[model samples]
Target: MIMPNEQKAPLVHLANAIGTMSEVSSRVGQYVLANPEKVVHQTVAELAEYTHSGQASVLRLCRQLGFKGFSEFKLALMAELAASERSTATDSDNEADRYGALLKRLTQSMQKTAYALHAEQLLAIAVHMVKARRISVFGSGISGLVSQLVSYRLMRLGLPAQAFQDPVLAHEVMTDVDKHCVALGISESGVTLDTVEFLKRARTAGAKTIAITGRVNSPVAQAADLVLLAVPIEPLTIGGDISPAISKIYLVELLAMAIADLSHAGRQRNERSKTP
Candidate 1:
């Protein structure tokens, strides 16, 4: 799908700025705006040839427009095109008639989650996991189940960790947490009072806390030292639906992979240092 020429799309902005760019960059930008369809489908080499500009010029144009690279620029262009198509498409009157729309929404939600995720935060959490002498995961309901999965995965990685759903037992465990402990709380709504209390208690006990929730402003988020958000979707959901649980699992898997990678890298570095 191609965006309307009248719209103020990302490419339009680049085209608008053509007057302000260097001569070579201006050539690349002008070619992109003039051949927007080609820009979408063509590789950097192909696009450069079409624009009669060097690859460096094309890359410079992307950088000048604040994109990290050509691939990111293309992705942004595609997103804008998708938005345009959605805006122009006729709506389905009923939910059942909009199955494709629902799927699209779910896909977009995951994409938005990826965009919202902060790499530095994940790295910081991984570092904390490596340093912590013990890890305790806490939650209730669906989130509690996800917490248990997280604990299981961490233990499988040879990390000392456990999960608790009982608020009383979880709190009692928090009392043993100290500077060397990492307490993780998983709550979709972020308003789970028991989870919040457990995090608060753990933090007060001098342990570092992490919150995995949908709402950043919730009590649980405020109590934790680090927050990792999972996508929340409850519209038109049936009772006891586990749609949001899928997102929670996705986030936990990401954390587990990061922790494993960091641990593996550390071990390899240690082995290298011990080499004769």
Candidate 2:
């Protein structure tokens, strides 16, 4: 039988340098290994509750496993799902096989795009959000939806953020953003006329500007203080623009979670300072 001290050793070790993992970290790792299938769909909070560990512990375990965090880990698992084609493979060798194959290919492509995201870049954006006095987000088309989501998440974390999808509003916001504020522009092509103009204006106004786009070499990226590049995966057909939209939304969610983590850490620090 394992003693209490023995049981605590793994957890303690994980708590200490959970930044590195080599086949083992804590009970969390053991649990994930045992239930690999479940890890694909589980959230950090769900995984923590499942393993009887804290949410932070789960995040630390993911970091130890060489992931930027839990979101990247989930993306990796989703890629595995795409590779296996668990949802598409069936015994129906009928005439509709062409459509089935196309659907499977599209899903796989989108999953690959998501898996290709750079976690470090998202984390860097989160760090900028934590320090910026104000944030203006801009995008057009589906990317506009992503910008709105990012702004909403940042606001919940107590950051001053606004999503300006309308060209007029974007220009107006850019003109008035404080010099110390940060402007984040989102676009898949990175060449959206309005987005590029707003980013340029924000930079000219002395605000730190960031561009989240699939095209790192585009004009919007060229004018920003920082650029977070998402992997580009446009649709193969005219009516299939949903894949890139979903990928962009996923990227926004990951950035939001990272910012939330930083915000919580800051709150802790402020509370500690108030303790006399």
lDDT of each: 0.75, 0.66
Per-residue CA lDDT of model 1 for 1-276, tens digit only, reads 223343335654664465566656755664464345557898999988765778888887777777767887888877776664664343344666466555654554454445445667888998898899999999898888899899998899888999999999998887788999999999987889999999999999999899998765568888999987665652324658676777677777888889989988999999999999
User: Whole-model lDDT for model 2 versus the true structure?
Assistant: 0.66
Best by TM-score: 1
lDDT of 2 by residue, 170-239 (tens): 8987767777789988877677888889888988998888887765446777778776545454223354
Off by over 4 Å in 1: 1-102, 234-238
The TM-scores of all predictions, comma-separated, are 0.65, 0.59
Q: Model 1, 1: alpha-carbon shift in Å?
A: 21
